[model samples]
Target: MHEFSIAQALVEQIEAAATKEHAKRVVRVVITVGALSGVDPEALRSLFPLVAEDTVTADAELVVEPVSARVRCRACGREEAAETSFLRCSVCGSRDVELIAGRELHIKTVELEIDER
Candidate 1:
């Protein structure tokens, strides 16, 4: 599954960050998952631990924040949350709209442990 690849990539990134920061251990990783990003959160979560094995983030907790799709209507200048893939302006019933959010897959935060010495 693609989620395995995504998890693998995530572990790679985490390992890089941990090494850069001279982290003794990784604690947690917080990421944002957009509704339109096409990555399933549950699947990603399931694969993360397996991919993280033997890595710096093997014991890290994964936190996923889900974001809803939002669109701005071009015809009526209306902005609203979208519930489906077919985007339409709720106020003006116009199909011409621009996606404002909910298309991002990004890491928000990483918690790490460092040796006091």
Candidate 2:
């Protein structure tokens, strides 16, 4: 599954960050996943530990924040939540809508453990 690869990439990024900060270990990784991002949260969670087996994030907790799809209507200038299967505006019922959110796939925060000398 592509989630495995995504998990691997995530672990790599965490490792890089941890190295840069000279962290002893990664405590948590918070990521935002959009509804339209085509990523399965459960799959990613299941594969994360496998990908992080030998990395600094081996024991890191993966926290996923799900973002709902939102769109702005071009006809009525109304903004509202939308379903992935439907791109129409809720208020104006216009098909001409611009996606405002719910396509994100990025790390929001990284909690790390550092050794103090």
Candidate 3:
């Protein structure tokens, strides 16, 4: 699935960062995921270990912060969470809305274990 590929890329990035920091291992990885990003967090979670196998992030914890889809209504000047299936303004019921959030998938932080020895 696409999750496997995504997880692979994520592990690669984490590994690179950890190596750059001279980390002994990775402790945790925090990522932000949006509802409209078309990514299944559970699937990604399940496949992360497989992709991170033998890497610094092998035992790292993956924390996914979920972000709800939000939109701003141009007609009513209101901002609120938008329905995933329909992108309409909740207040004015107008289709003329601008997406303010949701559609994000990025690494927020990475905790690492560095060795002085």
Candidate 4:
């Protein structure tokens, strides 16, 4: 699955960040997974460890925070939850809409531990 590649990339990114911060160990990596990001959270979670072997992120806790789909209607100026692949205003039934959320995959936080060595 492509989740392995994604996980590998994620671990590499975490390692880079941890190294830049001079961290002794990476304790946690919190990520926000959007509904429309097309990345399966469960698959990513299962594949993370495989790609993290021998890395600073090997034992880091991977916390996935899901973001629900949402859109902003241009006609009605209303923001509401939406289904994936459907961008319509529930109130005004307008096809003209702007995506406000649910299409992003962002690393929210990285919890690191520094050892006084």
Candidate 5:
């Protein structure tokens, strides 16, 4: 599945960062996933350990934060949560609405473990 590939890429990036920072291990990875990003968070989380095994993020915890879609109506100057299937302006009932949020997948923070010894 695409989740496996995504996990592979995440592990690679985490590993590279850990190496660069001279971290003994990665403690946690905080990621923000938008609802419109078309990513299955559960599937991605399941694939993480498999891909991260033997890597710098092997034991790292993966924290996924879900983001909801927000739409802004130009006709009524109103903003509200948009339905996943149909995004229409709640106030004006217009289908022409600008997506304000959702459709993003990014790593927000990385916690690392460093060894002084």
Candidate 6:
């Protein structure tokens, strides 16, 4: 599954950030995943723990926030939830709609612990 690759990337990012901030360990990683992002949340979570082995993020909790699919109709100026493939506006039933959200996959925040000397 591609979740392995995504998990690897997440670990790399977390390691870099933790090193830059001089963190002793990572506590949590908050990520935002859109409904249309095509990522399997269960699979992603399963891969994260494995990929984070022995890293600063090994003990970190992965928090995944799901974003809803939104679209705006060009003709009716209406905005509503959208389907994955069609992305049609529900209010106006128009196909000439622009996607407003639900296509994102990014790490929002990384909570880390600092060594207390």
Give the Cα RMSD of candidate 4.
Answer: 1.3
- Model 4 whole-model lDDT (C-alpha atoms): 0.90
Which lDDT tens digits does candidate 4 get at residues 12-64? 88998999989978999999999998899999999888888788788989999
lDDT of 5 by residue, 22-84 (tens): 999999999999999889999999999998998879899999999999999988889999987
lDDT of 6 by residue, 16-108 (tens): 999999999999999999998889988999989999998889889999999889998999999888777778877768899989999889999
Candidate 5 regions off by >4 Å?
none
lDDT per residue for candidate 2 within 1-117, as digits (tens), equals 799888888898999999999998999999999999999999999999988997889999999999999999999999999998989987878999999999999999999999996
For model 1, residues 10-117, the per-residue Cα lDDT tens digits are 889989999999998899999999998889999999999999988889999999999999999999998999875688898889999999989888988999998876
Each candidate's TM vs. the true structure?
0.94, 0.96, 0.94, 0.92, 0.93, 0.93
Give me the runs in candidate 6 sitting further than 4 Å from their true place: none
lDDT of 5 at 93: 98
User: How many Å off is the CA of 39 in candidate 2?
Assistant: 0.5
Best by TM-score: 2
Stretches of candidate 1 off by over 4 Å are none
Q: Candidate 3: what lDDT?
A: 0.93
Model 5, 61: alpha-carbon shift in Å? 0.7
Clashes of each: 0, 0, 0, 0, 0, 0
Model 3 misplaced regions, further than 4 Å = none
